[model samples]
Target chain A: MEKTILHLDMNSFFASVEQAANPNLLGKPIAVGGGIKKGSVVAACSIEAKAFGVKNAMSTWKARKLCPHLIVVIGDMTKYIYISKIITKMMVDYTDLVEVFSIDEAFMDITKTQDRFGGAIELAKDIKRRIKERFKLTCSIGIGPNKLIAKLAGELQKPDGLVVLREKDLPTKIKDVQVKELCGVGRKTEEYLRLLGVRTIGNLNSYPREKLVKSFGMAYGEQLWQMGQCHGASEVRPYFYETQAKSIGHSYTLPKLTSNTEEINGYLLRLSEQVGRRLRRENYKGNVVCASIGTGDDKTSSHQKKIKDFINDGYQIFKVAKSLLAITNKIRFVSVSVSGLLHQLDQISLFSHVENQKKVLAAVDKVNDRFGEFTIERAAIMSTGLQGKTGMVPPKLYGLRNFKMELRGIEPLTSRMQI
Target chain B: MVKVGTIIKVGVVFQGSKIIPRWFIWESRKYEVRSLDFTWEESQGLEKIIRFSVRDGINSYELAYNTIQMNWALENIC
Candidate 1:
């Protein structure tokens, strides 16, 4: 049976949310994320800012150069996460098979539920309307037979666009579009495809599969061939689906380039604690700890060490990370990550001190969870001047479990009668 | 923007699932909510705090209501 899928992409999500929250910011060019010092990159920008050629990931300085009056706002993750949860709940009213693609994008499989709303178009319009009515925000939604085509259709329109592209209409609708427009084709892949004279989706569809596989390798090349034919998986994993995290990491760039070991170690300790807290919260322990350092001259060196025992304690992770840091040059950035994960289970330590340490950490975790992140911190962190005002941390991705708003009791709105 | 974690009294109306903040008293002065621009919720452990971004005739303020404590606080101003 043919499946019906809808991809919904929020229009300039961060910027839009900021505008909705502040009446004065409405109808103005704005970007989210320059931190408190206004020295970082633009995480996202409004359509008004985009009109001035300001784009996401551009430096705030450059963005200012392009749009002199562009307002750069510090992001509030808690607010964004809360709104995202409410939006997800609204989507769940339509179908349980909803896959959150990102903080601002989602894919819903309404194959079984579309008929109840009369048809796919009606269902998509209803979702779009509900979102705009409740949040004063707009989204572009695409309706198609599979996720890829649905996403492509969504991309065809912007800021409250609704487009439908059936599998039968794929060839006519997208064949002339650039191969780079496909989801999986990145900059390097696009350049390689261009070298092969495959500029359009039509060219890729007719290109030799043998040549593709030989050039790109068997699995990915075969995948590209299928994408060229507009064939994609129809599966939409719901929020309840269990998924494992591969790694957990955090990195920070210093305000000024420094060779000071103590300051660098302070940053490392803070990052390690962040990683450890997340790992513990998720009941994960890892055997590998990796550390990286970036220098003033644009050089980065990284090292990883596999430990004998799995660990999730922040101090333990920090010890291993500190040992791995070589610090040959004056560095401005540092990162710490742990992988080789396993589900942590309750275990008794042979040493009494180790057991006591676990208890202490648990107590600390409880305090932080109750009050706020880093409510109880190490004295060393305070001395580093990084204690106050935590940066925005994006929610962990494991289905919709991280939303944490369901327990607050949100009553889903009843579906509108078919029109 | 200024961070003011000071606690203040707020008058609100609960209509179904919506929370409408009508007025708030801060620094011993009562300010009426000219507009309620945005609202959201955050969870800190077992407690859920409902936050509102509202504006008076002159200034904007952020107010948070702790569900467990049944109290309101002015969080920020701009």
Candidate 2:
């Protein structure tokens, strides 16, 4: 059977949520961003702000210059995640085949369930209506035979748009669209395509396959050909489907650029700990540790090394990352990540010290998992002033914690924030 | 906006699955909830919490209810 996929993309998600929560911001030009400091970029902008040529990912200063009256609100992950979860739940009510594309987007395989809800268009209308009524937010939904075309159709409209694109409609509906508009085609690829005189999707379709393969290699070239025909993967993996993570990493931008090794190491340790905590929580141990350092001049240096023994301890990860760190200029950003992951094999350690360290780490993980992240901290981090600065709590933690509470017939603390 | 992660007293009504905050006391002054702008739930360890973004007409405040403790706390003031 031909697949019927619906792609739902929230319009100006962060800014919309902010406006809904604070009525004062409604209909006003607003941009959701981090601290309005140097290098801070607008994460999302309201429709009012977009009218002034403000775009997402534009620097906050530049956005402010474009719309001087722009209300710059700090991005709040907790509220956004909450709203996203509710929206996801609503989608699941229609069909179990719901793939959360991002915090603000999802792809649903409504092939089976659409008929039950009168049809795909009816289901999409119901979803849009419910969202608007409940949260006062709007979303653009596109219906197509596959994910690629559905997403493309979604891009054709703006806030509260609903578009349907059948496979037969592809040639007439999107032949003139820019080739770069197809997902995954970056600026460099567009430039290369332009060199081949393939500027539109229609041009790409007519271009020789052998020539595309000769220029861009077999797999990518073939993928481009498929995209030109508006063909793509139709499988919508549900949210509950567990996929093994390829990497676990965290990075932090310092308040100010610094050349001090101690300060850099302090930030590195904090990042490693975060990465290590995530690794252990997911029951994965990795051999490769990657370190990235960003300089004040907008240059980044990244290095990764594989160790003999797989480890998930924060200090061990930090030691390996610190060795990889070789900085020359004043650094502003630091990152640590672990890759080459495998499910942690349960085995007794040969070294007595190593065994003790494992016990200590397990205990720390338990406490932090229950009370909050960084409930027990290292003496070194205390000196760094990053002791109590908690980041966003992962959704898995909330699910697990909520499950435990419900199982025990305990009243869940509604406002208990781990962040 | 002020982040006040302190405990405060509040009056609430549990209507079916909904939790409505009536009024809250912070620094010995009572502020009645004029409207609840938004509400959401969160969890920490084994504790589940419900948070409300409420306006008392003049200013907005974030109030949280800890069902396990059967208590209310003011989280933020805006």
Candidate 3:
């Protein structure tokens, strides 16, 4: 069976949103972040700002030095989230099997239904047109057989570009392009591959899988080899019920290192709430909680607690991290991370001591999910102020038993999807 | 260790003033307490400035942060 997948990405998301909302910012060198004194940096930069050599994540002070004319805007995450939900709605119109890959990216498995629609290329064109007409924003669309290929296609072009890649065109189109440009390829991986003279996708295609796996992890080695062949999976399963986290931790960088235990605890409470909210949203609860701190000198120390059971909720997670921080003096950075997750279980283990807390958290999750997130955030987090708002970051790992077999039927995994 | 006077820029997609030295930044908000990858030259005035970025009205505080701390005579540790 042939699969057609479509990936959509908003261009320069935050800055673009600012431009969309305010026409004046369109041609200007605009940055989205905190005011100068806020110690924030530019999260996104407009094309005009790019022209000035300004870039994302550059300090506002440095950005100002780089472009004195640059206009800065404090990020409005609420607005972006609103737009993201709307975009998700639009994606579902094309295929129910859509995976919200990131806040600004998604993959829609259109393979099984491509013949019913026009074709991969046509669908990509239509989706682009619809997005432009509806959102007044530009997006890059990539059409391919698997998520990896589809993601590659999306980046092949940018800012209202559409790219289509098929097996037949891989050999010719895959050459000349640097392998580092591939989705999963990063600085470390690229350097390692380059040492072996694997500079392009074509080069990787000829590399041995066993050797690659020995060097890279089993996952990356296999994924890269598959992507090299342009034969990755086409299965666009409904977004995974188990969301994998890139980093599962909460952190706060103090204005400077402080001995004030209250200030440190304040940050911990805020982070715990944020992490707990995310765990419950995805039906995951964690068993490992880690604490880390950074002194203003850029050095860090960390510790982890392996709990007998999993729990999710800001107050509890905060208690653990705070307990650890209580012993550390004059810390500059603080973080709380929970890992080793299990699906939300209905049956409470008879031996557990925190059942009452779990019950309270469940109610809170229901109310917040229904009304709006943060409708009932931890009171301790309130002092972090408006800027300390949290998000549904990636969720922690859940065990095999956590996955429901019923969801597998929605989309079958394929050869192309595996990589 | 990132020290005062460190001209450290976390994850910079590009240098603000020009394309020659600009690059993308990846450091996160949680990093505000410490200076991440920086050079000796970067630390020259690192003690005198606080830094952050704004994008499309959003802030990447952790990824992009710099600030100068008041100069306190260094206590040479063994």
Candidate 4:
């Protein structure tokens, strides 16, 4: 029997959630995005509003002009992420081989469990129906033999669409598809392929591997050919009640334009330690640390340091960051990324301080998880006083912390955030 | 990765080994089409341009407009 993969994607997820909750937003052109600030742009806009030329990444003001009646709403990530978590839970219950492709997209390997779920089509329909009834939003699903085709199939239809494709469906119908339809073929690739007189997938697949590799890079060219053949892996990642952190990074745009080193470092210090504790708790080790900052003038500066030997020590990262920040003066944004990750422990290094602090941080996390928040914070962190409010909350799991939705009724929380 | 602002139209759209483009755009301006793709030329005022292709079973003419352009597609054209 052939393998079965299902790709499920939510429709205008964030904006739809907002509109579903607020009855007034229905039938109106709605855009959900960053801020009213000039540089900020649309994150998601409704079908009605989309007709007005508003797009993701477009300035909110632009969207408004297109549809004078456009309703713009700032996003509440806490609520969206919470809902995403529950949806993930629903998918996991169906199969252990669930690959979380993104916050709102996932692929389930049901070839082995096909009989149990009635069939692939039945499973997809059930998932869609459940998601719509509970969230009052729509979704599109694609079923195929591999992850690439499944995702492609999902994209072929959208917003409450379902499409299933098999090997038998190819050639006559699939071969006529544009060259750009293949997975991972982006805009640049499409344009470049067009230059080569290759606009359809049928032509791209017929091109010899050597010719493709010569034109594009070896990796990309070969990958494209494989996509045409649908020979890639669709192996699903094991589903787990707990998930390990893949990467740890933090970015903050300066609340106010400033060149003050003290202010900058204070923020960096808090950010670094937060990253460190999370890494340690997950038993992760990172070898590369990057520091990126935007200037008040709108220009940006960034530098990264890779320790030949990696260490997850929060203070050490800060020590390195201090120099990275000194190179350029004015600041508007600051970000740090921890990479070259190792999944777990190795016998290579020993630090008593790390062990002790790891225990404390874990305990703190537990305490915070049980009782509303980080009711108890570190004294070292107190040195910065209060850092003020933030639009983003710490990355969290549904039940891990006080997963309250600023919008009431989304979650049964003790406190409610009103419009 | 069709972003929120990406523009698409109705007609024939393609992406590599797949010739099943259900939508196309007549205008050069980018769009962020919210619903089904696959539009016609005469109704919308342009010939054929699709930001991307999607399979909606049947590309409906219920969406037909002689200046068939979707309100979203027109916004970018301006």
Q: TM-score for every candidate vs. truth? A: 0.92, 0.92, 0.69, 0.70
Cα RMSD of all models vs. native, in order, equals 3.3, 5.2, 15.6, 16.8
Among these predictions, the greatest DockQ belongs to 1
Query: Which 10 successive residues of model 2 chain A have the least lDDT summed?
Result: A404-413
| TM-score computed on alpha carbons, candidate 3 | 0.69
Off by over 4 Å in 1: A36-38, A296-299, A392-419
lDDT tens digits, residues A1-419, model 3?
Answer: 55778889888888887676555466888888765643456888888898889998787889999999988876755456556656666666556677766667888988765665687777777777876775567889888778777888888987788999886787898677888878878988899999988998889988898988887889888888877777676666565354455335556666556777666777777778777776776567787888888876667888888777577767878877776754456666777888887775456657566677777788877766554455676666666553325322212112221222212234433422434
Residue A38 of model 1 has an lDDT of 37
Candidate 2 residues lying further than 4 Å off, grouped into runs, are: A391-419
Give the lDDT of residue A59 in candidate 1.
74
Isolated chain A: TM-score per model? 0.92, 0.91, 0.80, 0.81
lDDT, candidate 2, A67-153, per-residue tens:
999988877766777788788878877877777777788999999879979999999999999999889899999999999889988
Candidate 1, CAPRI quality class derived from DockQ: medium
Please provide, for model 4 over A311-338, each residue's C-alpha lDDT reduced to its tens digit, 9 standing for 90 to 100.
6666767777766766346677787767
TM-score of chain B of each: 0.94, 0.92, 0.20, 0.18
Model 4 regions lying over 4 Å from their true place:
A241-247, A253-263, A294-301, A307-315, A326-332, A342-367, A370-388, A392-419, B1-78
The regions of model 3 sitting more than 4 angstroms off are: A208-211, A217-219, A240-249, A253-259, A278-284, A295-300, A326-333, A346-419, B1-78
Question: Cα miss at A318, model 2 (Å)?
Answer: 0.5
User: TM-score of model 4 relative to the true fold?
Assistant: 0.70
Model 3: lDDT of residue A329 = 60
